[model samples]
Target: MVLQQRREPYPHWEYTDPSGAEVLRVVPERGGLVTGWSSLGRDWLYFDAERFADPDLSVRGGIPVLFPICGGLPDGRLPLPQGVFTLAQHGFARDRAWELSALEGGDGVRLTLAHDPHTLAAFPFLFRLSLEYRLAPGQLGITAQVANAGEDPMPFSFGLHPYWAVDDLSAVRLEGLPAEGFDHHTMAPATLAAQLEALGEGVDLLAHPAGPVRLRGVAGGAAVTLEPDAPLDLVVLWTDPPRPMVCLEPWTAPRGALISGDRRLLVDPGGCCSLSCRYRVDRGWG
Candidate 1:
């Protein structure tokens, strides 16, 4: 009737809210990624165990944390005031090990990652990030906090990439998208509907909608709704056919935010910003 927290085998911490009918698997060492989320006896996330088990590969599934930069910089280099630093795509947050601990009520877990010598060598900034995850009934929530620990302002973009499970990619009915969006592959304007139709061939597009996004017709008969807080409402839809997974992600900025400074946010010294989002489930929405 309460909740439970247990360390599973290597690198995984399990959190289950028995009262809420939800279960989650967290891997602090794997970018604080939520490798699994289950509700109402059905798994809502897609995970690739093989890639996840290998430390040298970028995880194909689960929710990978994106920070400092969402996409990539020119030639994989970032020119800062101090000097030019080599940062790979999506920055180093997703590759670093995080410190994990249970929340005060034992109802959730907090995973924290801070800058170290290795990160400083690439990012040249003093920063700290905290991710808190909690579940209740038919809902799962996450609160991400970023602090600027350096003397100067910190420019950054943050995002979460969640791979949702879907047996038939064509049956995925996603609503609440604007009419137009940007295609990641082509870098051209496109209609969101067209992208959904091409799911079988593979689709990657980003859109910004005002209200909650409704996702239905997954493998199971259940429905999911993503509710993201302000400034983090940018939605990106991606699919790799034959994998049975579709990623409906929330981002604070589009690709190249840091490079172009478009919608990029800056946190002043000693200041912190908090962003929160939640996902709710329902039945028979198909």
Candidate 2:
């Protein structure tokens, strides 16, 4: 299994197993995004080729890295000891480019990004972020590490937003979530039973205990399993009506953590923290 470099619409790395049972592509130039993953020639990731072509538009699909802050801030402003800084939804890491640091055998690749002057102006912290993507026979593992390089402690949140390909949003069912969660739009109370019963257009839950979340009843008799190393504080379930895709997000904190201070990660100076999650596909599920 050798890693192949390709230059087309953008620069990317591709890996294919010897048996041709799996293939994965990563775009280091686009925030180290995993653009595609396929098993048995079946794509498991939802990506918009048109949106990806536009350099200005943030790619709507794939696994987008959410760091420093997982969701939106109150009024898009973060209050710090120094002052108030304007931070956008999901932070700035996804909008910036990440450097490809390592390629492990044919199964893994590592990308790293650090704070620069532009990042400091908004985040006011010195930190290094590393993301590693590894592929197995039937699983894809994502590991993220954030190192605080500043003298002061760093406050942040992190998450992964993956758009999964589904045949029908109405036919999907998610299990292993907490009995209750919170709504993203209204911040209203929500429950696992109600979500399953209603199957609403969109829903968001916060602070779920760490465990394996499973999605079953996908089109073509497939299923997806997500297992995180630690319990995530937030879980987001959303999809657009009439679209054959849904996003199951895992977050360290809920939206507006910068103001609520709820589940925010505080890394001490010279210290680091890490989190990881694995996605497995079951092709024979019925």
Candidate 3:
């Protein structure tokens, strides 16, 4: 493995395989975001560097870490036993900076996020989040560890929103997802297939695959299969067409799970919870 620093365009850590067939670039200050990834002679991630240049905008591409909560709360308020806290959509981990370090005696990188004043103000808990990222010939794997450093058990949800590049949105198809799901567009239950067919508009729905999900592009394009670990197997499908991209997000719980107490995961005090997921890529229509 070869690790180098690239300053142009932006400051990020670039790691590559000796074979030079795989590459990954990450920006720690940007929520430990994976800005770009390439394998099998093709770029798998869709990154909007133009928008990324502006600091005020939320990242439109790359893999954004969702933590503490999967989605927004009622009026951005989380009524915990401690008190009522204002937690934004997807929590604050994705917006705050993270510390990045090379894996010790390993072949990848590790990014760590600890509790800060801002986070405590929102979630009111001391926690540590460590993410280890690695790459192979045609795959990317991530292992996430969340530790509750406080004296009380912490209730939270975790997820990863990865924007994948494609040749054509209309030509993309995903297998292994449930046939029905809640559509965020209309805020109603709808068929998953029909939601995906609206290429001109967009899609934002959570599908409970409860396992792995496979996505394929047009002929001669890219194919990706996402296999998430238990408690994080649900997939959120999203796309804003005309950009040739789609986001297959793996989530630990459905939106509003924290308040609804539906499938919400908890970490005991002084205990850590570990989860993992993998993405395998290739070239093919199906």
Question: Which number leads on lDDT?
Answer: 3
Candidate 3 displacement at residue 212 in angstroms: 2.0
| Clash pairs for candidate 2 | 207-233, 210-231
- How many clashing residue pairs, candidate 2? 2
Q: Which stretches in model 1 have alpha-carbon errors above 4 Å?
A: 1-11, 18-20
Tens digit per residue, CA lDDT, model 2, 42-130: 88888887888898887878888887898787788999997899988899888888887445565677889999998999999999999
Candidate ranking (TM-score, best to worst): 3, 1, 2
Report the lDDT tens digits of candidate 3 across residue range 1-286: 7778899678888987767787889998998899998887877888899999998998988899999998788799998899999988999889989998777745678899999988999998899999998888778999999999999889999999999988788788888889998787787888987977885489899878856788888225768999988877888899987777889988889878878999899999999999899998877545
TM-score per prediction, in order, is 0.94, 0.91, 0.96
Q: Candidate 1, clashing residue pairs?
A: none
Worst 10 residues of 1 by lDDT: 1-10
Higher-ranked by TM-score: 1 or 2: 1
- Give the lDDT of residue 123 in candidate 3: 90
Give the clash count for each candidate: 0, 2, 0
Candidate 2 regions exceeding 4 Å error are 7-11, 17-20, 197-200, 207-210, 231-233
CA RMSD per model (angstroms)? 1.9, 2.1, 1.5
